[model samples]
Target: MCSLCGVLGCDDHWTSAIARPGIYTRNTDRLARRREAANRIRLANALLEPSRLKIAEWQGASYVLSSPTGRTQVFESLAHLWPEVEAMTARALDPLDPDFLERLKQRIEAAP
Candidate 1:
């Protein structure tokens, strides 16, 4: 539920809910995509555990950067911030390269 709209899944339903009226905003969309990608990476890291990587409790929560590759990643600190950790991972990795960003920009620009 969104505090502003008092609607469930408002963020999903209204693409520009976080933006000012008639203004351009990519923060919400980018954050969402980053979150999705981060979760996938986190899951993959979990599967590779005991073989390719391992996770230890960091301050009471499971950290995902214990993986071999994760250690080398700039987003390694993401292991400490779960849930919202996706944004950290995305910024660190910059997974959305030029090509993907171009497509995303087009989509957002075309939106009504």
Candidate 2:
């Protein structure tokens, strides 16, 4: 989907939150949820960095996945992220793959 449409959408993906974002009445809950969402993006980027793929929050409701080549896809849920990443980058993303894990570990250790 296009970025504009995704931004206009009111509901967040179920996988994007620990609790529903729209049902809360407190500011603290909103802040906590925002923090959780940012953390999710950070961790996902770690696994994606080797492939030169990255994802960012799209208006707090959806995610925008992009490739080093400039191709992009906007997806609303974590469920859709992997497939989009694979298709956009032309690389199979296996979070559990031994080599991928090793790369991630090395990247983490190498970070200064």
Candidate 3:
């Protein structure tokens, strides 16, 4: 069943198999990617030292974080980290079993 639709799993009565595919799959994929990217970016930002991150708070505005030199180096580092993040997201989106980043890291280490 589609959780959003409140349908039970593998129920043909609720799902229209012959008709055009539902938009859920594509939207779900997109949402998953967005979430994964956000998570990775957040983590990468967290890894920066205080001097590097330079996070600040504003009453109604978003905070900004950057290096002491005004260079946003965290985003540059993200490209190098994206492959691992992609694999982690893929594993997370898997229905059967979705291990968090810890297990994902072990899998990456074990991979050839």
Candidate 4:
């Protein structure tokens, strides 16, 4: 009676081919995790936008910062990427923080 049941239960070659054991579920889970990570990154970047900072993935395990000047700085650790970016944005929001860029560079360089 369900729409999915009707389509999946139908005698169709396409459905049969894709309905293999564990294939659909495994792929769905992987895609869902990827989507969730992407969404988190998007939300975090949105928060950073007002501070003139943006975080982007440089490679699978690296993150890059896009500054207002169009300069890019790549950090080689995923573990410290978000925290460092958040810290930078927090400091950047304050007009008194003239050392934010230096601090960001130090933090990224120190990240393992």
Which wins on lDDT, candidate 1 or candidate 3?
Answer: 1
* TM-score list, all predictions: 0.24, 0.73, 0.30, 0.45
Question: In order, what lDDT does every prediction score?
Answer: 0.39, 0.71, 0.35, 0.51
Order the candidates by TM-score, highest first: 2, 4, 3, 1
The parts of candidate 3 lying over 4 Å away from their true place are 1-28, 54-65, 73-112
Residue 64 lDDT in model 4?
75
**Candidate that would win on TM-score:** 2
Off by over 4 Å in 4: 1-28, 86-112
Candidate 4 scores a C-alpha RMSD against the true structure in Å of 15.6
RMSD each, Å: 13.3, 4.7, 15.3, 15.6
Clashing pairs in 3: 1-8, 1-9
What would the per-residue lDDT of candidate 4 be over residues 1-112, giving only the tens digit for each residue?
A: 1354221222122322353342232234444434544564576576565467888754333567777777666765445655676565555254246565555556567758
TM-score of 2: 0.73
Ranking by lDDT: 2, 4, 1, 3
In candidate 1, the residue pairs with backbone N, CA or C atoms under 3 Å apart (3 or more residues apart, or in different chains) clash, namely: none
Top of the candidates by lDDT: 2
lDDT: the better of candidates 1 and 4: 4
Q: Candidate 4: what lDDT?
A: 0.51
**Candidate 1 — worst ten consecutive residues by lDDT sum?**
7-16
Off by over 4 Å in 1: 1-28, 52-112
